[model samples]
Target: MTKKNWNINLKEMVKVGVHFGHETKKWNPKMAPYIFKERQNSHIINLTYTARFLSEACDFVFDGAKRGKQFMIVGTKHQTADAAKLAALAARCHYVNKKWLAGMLTNWFTTEARLEKLKNLMKKKNTGGFDQFTKKEAAILRRELNKLQEDLGGIRYMKKLPDIVIILDQKGEYTAIRECRTLGIPTICLVDTDCDPDLVDIPIPANDDGRGPIRLILKKLILAIRTGRAL
Candidate 1:
């Protein structure tokens, strides 16, 4: 990582609205320790913790990247989808920007079968094999490919389970969190006040809704991953 990247601080993060959290009424009791206090009926996350935890999470990711770890980027919420997609693309990792499949990680066998179908179809389409088929048959394969691309295009090359999972909104993407937990994969989550930090392996308390903060974090993370590769 660069010397400048190590200096991630609360001042810049606050300018990006990273300190904002859920309303007081929506806050989880378990997150009280990380809460700074309440203002205007909204719970403010501890920016001090945000700076510290986010840096730590970035370092963890860098270390893993150096070890050739594969990550599954997850941010299904409207606020975070773009950040997730950009991070995954920059890091050359798989991502789920749309809805996550129910049994994607848990039911690996069934999911792999579906992925195999996508691969075969892609191969046929690429190799001119599909030209031998009738227009109706070719159209069917094209439709299937388009549908799968919307859902699994980012991860089509993932032959095995990911080594790590990085997510923007922990509370919103609870299903992904649960599946990662089930498989005992290390997870990093941007947890808001309404979320239970305990649920994630590395919890960085910050606002998950705003695109600015998410983009900042994602950019830094991607930088760290790239640094790992160069190392």
Candidate 2:
């Protein structure tokens, strides 16, 4: 099949997935029976639309990367939805770690230093120096360390604004959008029906609320990057 036809088929599959959840009575009654059938239907439509939008956005990312454009992947709260962020990294686009700590984006050198510290700690753990704590303490420390690293990494590429900003959640990343606007960069966003599309240059109307949609979108983008279409 032609690439266009393949894309159309993928888009239709997303629509079907969304339609599956339509009608409160249609939902797996085990989940939340109180919600109206219409609400459930709305949920399905949002998710399906999001999946299709993400798939297309991935194609755009691939094309842009091939042309040597800089893209930024931004998301709020959900690291699992960060498939596009990973793709941008693979494509050599500057990636802002989604868990970036406050002020890290505005202060790159400090963030890099913190990342270095985390790296050193990881190295120490790898080597024989650090004493082994109880599982609880070890787990807690590891978690804290991981958080620190995520925060530091998130803003590592902030010195230069991206040419295009791909935002997974419009409401979640208001600050990121503000920053993008300040830099006059174009934005491509996965916008839920509840969101206003005016904020984004390229708005892919879809459900920005669920993990399934996020996962599907990220997977497609990662695939594109891996295939070298994203360069």
lDDT of 1 by residue, 113-173 (tens): 8888889988888999889989999898899988888878878889999998998988788
How do the residues 1-231 of candidate 2 rate in per-residue lDDT, one tens digit apiece?
112211434454364342233333433332232222354244344443444555666666666656666666777566433664565565555555455345444444676677677777777678843566777877776786777656655534444545677777777777777666666777887655455667776666544566655555555655654454424
Would you list the C-alpha lDDT of every candidate in the order shown?
0.87, 0.56
Off by over 4 Å in 2: 1-6, 10-56, 68-72, 78-100, 128-144, 153-164, 229-231
Give the clashing residue pairs of candidate 2, or none. Answer: 18-44, 22-41, 24-37, 50-206, 97-154
- Measured against the true structure, the TM-scores of the candidates, in listed sequence, are 0.94, 0.59
Worst 10 residues of 1 by lDDT: 1-10
Task: Please state the error at residue 21 of candidate 1 in Å.
Answer: 0.9
Report the Cα RMSD per candidate: 2.0, 8.0
Which pairs clash in the backbone of model 1?
Answer: none
Runs of candidate 1 with Cα error greater than 4 angstroms are 1-5
